[model samples]
Target: MTRAPAHDLNAEQAVIGAALLAPNVVAELAGTLAPADFYRPVHGRLWEALCAMQATGQPVDPIALAARLADSGDLGKVGGAPYLHTLIQSVPTAANASHYARIVADHARRRQVADLGVYIAERAGTDTDVAEIVATGRAILDQAAAGSQWSPLIPLGNRRHLPDFPGYVLPEWVANMVYGVAEFTQTPVDLAGCIALAALSTAAGGRAEVEVRGSWREPTNLFTVVVLPPGSRKSAVFAAMIGPLLTAERALVERTKPAIVEAELAARVAGKAAEKAANAAANADQSGRDTLLAEATAAAMNADAVTIPVLPQLVADDVTSEEAASLLAEQGGRLAVLSPEGGIFATIAGRYSGTPNLEVFLKGHAGDMLRVNRRSRSPEHVEHPALTLGLAVQPDVLRDIADMPGFRGKGLLARILFSLPENTVGRRKIGADPVSEQVASAYTANLGALVMTLAEWTDPAVLPLTPEANERVLDIERAVEPRLAPGGAWGHLVDWGSKYTGAVVRLAGLIHLAEHLRDGWGKPIQAETVERAGLLGDYFAAHALAAFDDMGTDKSTRYARLVLAWIERTAATTFTKRELYRGVRSQIPTAADLDPVLSLLEIHGYLRQLNAPARTGAGRPASPSFLVHPEVHGSAGTVHGLPGWASRRPA
Candidate 1:
């Protein structure tokens, strides 16, 4: 695939030409133009227009000129007429002639001033005398003619050109004054005139125009250049001129050396303002990060305060000193273990008290302890025998007990109820018999009541697992019957048959039994079991028969047939060849019954005279196989089985 052009340089070139010829148009072609535009013929045409305009008396109006350009199919060739028009319109108006002249003059003057200083400094090499520097500048200017690259002069419509002058005057002929008078005599003519000259050279490039404004107090030498490339309103070339302009301004200031210190003060103020803005932004960012962190911390603390009932219990039996230390560090509080007489048995108060070792205190204490701690506040301790001991229990064990038959909360009562024998409900049930009425009543009164109370106290999702356990408990709810009804025995047998090791055969047998029971006994059984068994048996039989047939031997078939006959005889039935064949086939035996069945049918006169054989290349007999009775093969037996060697006997 052909790659499309990234930029349409032909279109850009047309716009550039239009922009350059426009009246009062300024050019700042300091750097390389787009490479494509450089090789195009349009650049020469634009240059010719500029030369023609300058050489002739007639001035070119960008609007009228652009309108005429519309006829030149070449200009509109790139299909960018609209873009070209907008670019032409952006060119500065010629009507602002004085303003344009001032800009041109200021640009040229700055260049002249810089050139004068550079020339003086170069010539003064090792000679620091101000007069020598002045003489060096004059000599350089004398060598450069009007419109020369190094000259501090601008070409003005061919009629206005620099005249030949011997020496320079202070004010009138001081247009080419050197840095000596500019620095020592403190003249404004040298600096101002140099700026105007630099502006003129820049305007000839056909890209952008520069306008300058000067201030003594603030030294506000503003250089404004319009960006070029026609469509681009901002170009790097325009921005680049700012650095040179600032440099020229500083040079002018140093040469003048006036006491107007306001410019320096203004610069200092601007610098400080910039620094203050940067500092404030940095501080605001830091403050935002700190506020976010604080909010996150508060949210984490609030979540931790709400207890989840399903939360797994800690495995530790007693809180160790390490755990206590950690808790103390986290809470920034104290832990204390005291005696009933108000004497300190063990005081781990302060940062060490609330550590995970609280279990140790519970294990040592006899009475139940009161855990008086607000969720968000410091915890206090009170001792009570029953309450304290419960805190030491494992959560999983507690969950299991709560789910036990008729057990409840209040550890003392739950323990008392658990102490009874497994068969005993409350106090009357004994042995492996059903629970007595008296025991049931007591259990309902004491254990059941306690369970109900605990259920109410706990969260719904985390209430005792008792209800779930009770639902799954196995028991004889209905009276047992002595004998199974007609369908009942078969249904139970099918279920029991599922437990047999040889699942396939047993399943098949169950199916046959169901059919026998249904047909002979006239007992209707579910049709699903019969269907499933039939399907499974057919699959097994097909596989087994295929295995035997693949053996391709009469002996193999006879042995397989014998196995099937024995099975049928043991089961007390005259096994039809089909049924006997299926049982052997279902086991995927070494011998298949298909050939044997064919042989049997042949002997039984079912099959008549067989076909002959073909001769091989070695003249040996080739026993070709053929179709037989379709009923024996089970389908349209167009396809033959294995070759029968007996069919190929010497004819």
Candidate 2:
């Protein structure tokens, strides 16, 4: 006997009723609940009508819904106008209509799982590769994880919650600038923080380093990836905030060009002198030869003294590891990579290198000594290199990088701080006055001072933590270390959590310099700055957990998810191999492809295999039958029933 699919008729009625009662409900529920989520055919059709009306920006009242349904020949099946009245009467209020929709969505998922199981059973003995079946299973599970149409790991701006900058603990100047700036661009205030951090890191450069504990000093470099949808002002925000740095670098390069030309000309003159000296030495008497060699050495020394400035490049949008290494050497190991379109991720992941260049990036972030040797070029090395990466990519691009090979396992992405704020594109009031001159002046002045401070660095001494700051650093270590320990709360994010302590110290150094340092850069960070940086660590920890959760969803369990959904929906205990195909063929396209799903099902204890005697006289083999576990419901359970593992729950 087949059990009727799980559904909440009242919830379906309430969702429809709420929408009919309040047309505005359509907007809120549109992202999470689909028309097929409704349990009843009439409810599903009615919800579809409401959505169709909403799509055209029309009112979703009774009149509009009825017209849509009647036009689609669905009005009669759903009890016409009277049924609409009954649906409207089902809801007490429209405030929780979104909640009601959630109920509908949950039941719909259960129903889908049941349907997927039928497909799994039918395809179990077929020709489909196990990998394909597993992929489909993984797809279903991914759908379930993102059932709310929002993934914390794979951020979609349409469904994220934007951070409140006014609520953030920022410098008074930054706080003041954020309101006018975010409003003008309709960007999240968090973007302000990201850009500010980058500028601060660029300012601090290789001049300042943070020593959190013994032998664990990290440069004040930051890597922030802000996820947003296309046209949500990512490029605009990036340009507005980072534009000043670009200007400063360009101006520096221009100023140095004259010296560079002079140095090259002087070097050429000295080269000719050295060549003439060498020729004279070839033919001169013994005493004359000695004099000529001495003159040549003098000329070579003079040529060396006429040094040209390297191009002043503090930030690059896209560059290979080789190029970046050279920049770090030229800029005293302080460099930034900023791209609003997220080309940097692709660049690092082999659009140019044919292999991920994460090793160089990781070394740069850690401010470790980096040595890069190219095939035909002299080996370049930098001591204490700092690479600050600021990237803004659409949700799809983030997904692409997340799917890139070796990201999660290599923890390449885990090193980055991610911000996915709700989009404010359509809601902002644009055309505000240019950023307040007072705020702009302060920001630029601070950045200029930071640049000059780096310019004044004759000695590269590590910045030591104050005694109070050292204690706070220890506290941060103690706080995050336990979480990475065995049976810890954040064991899932140990890869990221492992480095957060150092990140906090680096953040403290940046904040201290950005706020307090004026003409000089070697001052120790204050205790208050350490405390504030710890607060930021907490904030980033929350975001990291969200990102890791999405990334942690295993890739192999996909097919099993579909099979499990199908199994849960059926009331029947046993299904023969051929009989299962008949039931699930409609849901799963190819009967031959379910081999992995069914084999997985039996292997996991969701189903048990048995052989039945074949019918007489045909010398036939025994027929296969699978019995689903009686207790196989949606609660605590196992997919594989492996030893030393608890029943895995759906995320």
Candidate 3:
């Protein structure tokens, strides 16, 4: 009394019949369904023939298929001419061939899994090392169970269509580089544009604050994160945008080196003189000791007063929150953390001490007073710290960090501007032209000049808004303030929406400075520049809404999304819980972990769990399986805000 092999006779016949009746169905299922997926030997033979005929430009009607079978000497073995007609009559409609093919493939996978299980059991019973047995077992199981967790591509309920980046809003030099990098790398301009603002922030962060209104000012520093999937070539975009800042930092260091050397030499000589005076005071008579001690103290004070400036450090890639604070103090209260990875979030989430250390980042973005007191070392303090953040990371990081202890609770997420750029992975043109030398040179020179020029400001320059600009800023504030009410459009995002106008003001400052890079101090920001910043603000607002919504998704929903991505890739129509768990074991560690994910998927209309057959005899019942929606294999519209969404073309 053994169980029959896992397969579906009806699905096999239906797929064969559909391929014979309509050639187009064969083309649709060609990628996912192979001849070996059919349960019956004759059906597999006929499917192979039909595929071969299609490949060779031959028609695949019953008569033509029979002739092909005869040529291959498989006609008599396949039950001859009558069986071909029978296959054609089995399918009621050819349009359902993809659905039938999925069924066939699913059953084939089930049979393979069953055989694999038997093989593993036999190996386990052998006189072999347990590690060897487990290793070999996992390898074969992974190969067989690769794609069972796949769910159909469907939009989550909270997903929103994001606005395109307002590349036109940037100044000509900035826009030229944004578009040029976009063209060269074939990525969205949003990435380069956001980074451009961050670069600008690095230059002018602590140097200036834009006065929005009476006693209301916004710092030029910004925290911007662009979300893209892996393989989007984000690093290339970051390097191209951040290269100028690195060059300018080196130039600034070189320009200020002589003064630094002079100050350092003076401090050293004063310290040596103070040491000699202290020794002389120790050996002097009681009356002279007091005078010599006073002199030594005076010399030590002069040495401390002759402070040597720290070398100009404009950017840092990886540093802990404490290190960032020290760098800010060393560099006149300005620092930018620019990276292509989002590991900074983990670092900020207390990766070292297991306690959240967000005081530096929290105060950095707000331009608040930051003081760091340490034992046995000089304390570090900044009257107005301006820390800029420019990061490009995979979208999943947003979901992952949402659960960190104080990331959202402390308003860290709210303070940053998020951009969810469209991923252009598979459609990118190979051997695309590189950025033109003229555009590249102009961008490098202009951005470098702006950074260096702003670094010279010893005091915060108030970039005043024109009368028209002031009115527009007021209007934006008014419009946004009401939406933050309890039942308004932005009620759920009060923290983020409350800071929208401030972000706009900061953007306006960056735009104005970029427009007049060489002589931006004491200048008024025009209404047009504010208007462009407002548009850019709107773009970020839409993306933030989408990003926060995605970040707010529960663990089960996120896991369900991973499952769905697998389903769409494999086009799987049915599977058991054990099967799905094995396929997604990395994300979903155990079968128990998959239960809630399956329930969520079922709620989202991606799957329906079928009841197990009534128990026969005293043995345990079989595992329940899910039936995937038929439309999963059909022409569903594109799903945005999900993993693997199609990338949009260049704007």
The number of the candidate with the highest TM-score is: 3
For lDDT, candidate 1 versus 3, the one ahead is 3
Cα deviation of 435, candidate 2, in Å = 2.3
The lDDT-based order of candidates, best leading, equals: 3, 2, 1
Predicted structure with the largest lDDT when compared to the true one:
3
- What is the TM-score of candidate 1? 0.14
Assess every candidate by TM-score.
Answer: 0.14, 0.59, 0.66
Cα deviation of 508, candidate 3, in Å: 0.6
TM-score computed on alpha carbons, candidate 3: 0.66
Cα lDDT tens digits, model 1, 264-336, are 5554555565555445454666657666555555554544444322211111113434443333223212222
**Which candidate, 2 or 3, has the higher TM-score?**
3
Q: Provide the lDDT at 197 for model 2.
A: 73
Higher-TM-score candidate of 1 and 3: 3
Cα displacement (Å) at residue 122, model 1: 2.9
Name the 10 consecutive residues with the lowest summed lDDT in model 1.
416-425
